[model samples]
Target: MREVFPDAGFREPVEAAEIVEAERRLGQALPTDLRQLLLESNGVLGRTRVATVWAVDQIVEQNLRFWSDENFAQLYMPFDALMFFGDNGGGDQFAFVQKPQRPDVFVWEHESDSRR
Candidate 1:
């Protein structure tokens, strides 16, 4: 990940407790690798040339905002099933599907209102 985003800047490391609390509040467990990344650095700053990974708090805030939007919520029902982690410099977002088995990562584009 670092090699792909050499210019990425990171926030101070976050506590495991914080990550756990975030998961609890969201009513879902985050992916293991993402949880580990948050413990290392809250999130990445600067441009990754892909997306800027949002800090834990930002993650919650953004998710809440999206979940509250009628249009978005309706379009993406069961929004809780997806955990948003980052965003393209534009309005697109990145997330992981919370399934029992492998959690596949996907990109949600605001322009298209579609996930890929």
Candidate 2:
């Protein structure tokens, strides 16, 4: 992360217990890299002018919000299968599609509700 965002500022690291709690709330284990990152710093900020990596709580909140939206609910069904991690200033988000053994990351476009 630092290599990609040299000027980034981060929130204080969250406790391992907190991460574990987040995982329990989300009903899935976070990817190892992401878990480690959260342990290092709950989130990244002031990286570039366009984005912020969300903290564990924010991730859960956003996912819950999206999962409950009438329009997005069906699209994001099986909610626990997706993990949102960041947002672009423009409203788009970044996330990972959880798989049995690993997660595949993608950029989720807000306007189209599509992932790529």
Candidate 3:
């Protein structure tokens, strides 16, 4: 993180207990790397002070809303396969593919509801 944005901002690490509760409530384990990152720093702020990696609470809330909210469901394709963790400081969000749990990350564009 420091290497990428020498001045990037970071928050205090979160407890393992929080991670455990997050997984339990979300019904899935977070990606191992992401889990470790959150334990080291709850979130990372990159260019323009945007959340390059969101806080654990934000991750849970966003994912839950994307997966279960009626409005999102009606507007976009099912989001259960993705585990969102960041954004581009714009409307584009970053996520991990969770259905088969691949190592590659994907970008979800809010405007078009497209993933790439």
Q: Highest TM-score: give the candidate number.
A: 3
Task: Return whichever of 2 and 3 wins on lDDT.
Answer: 3
Give the Cα-based TM-score of candidate 2 against the true structure: 0.82
Candidate 1: pairs in clash: none
What is the C-alpha lDDT profile of model 2 across 48-70, one tens digit per residue?
Answer: 64437788999878877765677
The reply for model 2, stretches above 4 Å from the true place, is 48-51, 74-80
Candidate 3 ranges beyond 4 A from true positions: none
Alpha carbon lDDT of each predicted model: 0.78, 0.77, 0.94
Worst 10 residues of 3 by lDDT: 1-10
lDDT of 1: 0.78
Q: Which scores higher on TM-score, 2 or 3?
A: 3
Query: How does each model score on TM-score?
Result: 0.83, 0.82, 0.95
**Candidate 1 — worst ten consecutive residues by lDDT sum?**
72-81
Q: How many collisions per candidate?
A: 0, 0, 0
Q: In candidate 1, how many Å is residue 78 off?
A: 4.8
Cα lDDT of model 3 by residue, 1-116, tens digit: 68767978999999999999999989999999899999999999986899989999999999998898999889999999999999989889999999989988999999999999
Regarding lDDT, does 1 or 3 come out ahead? 3
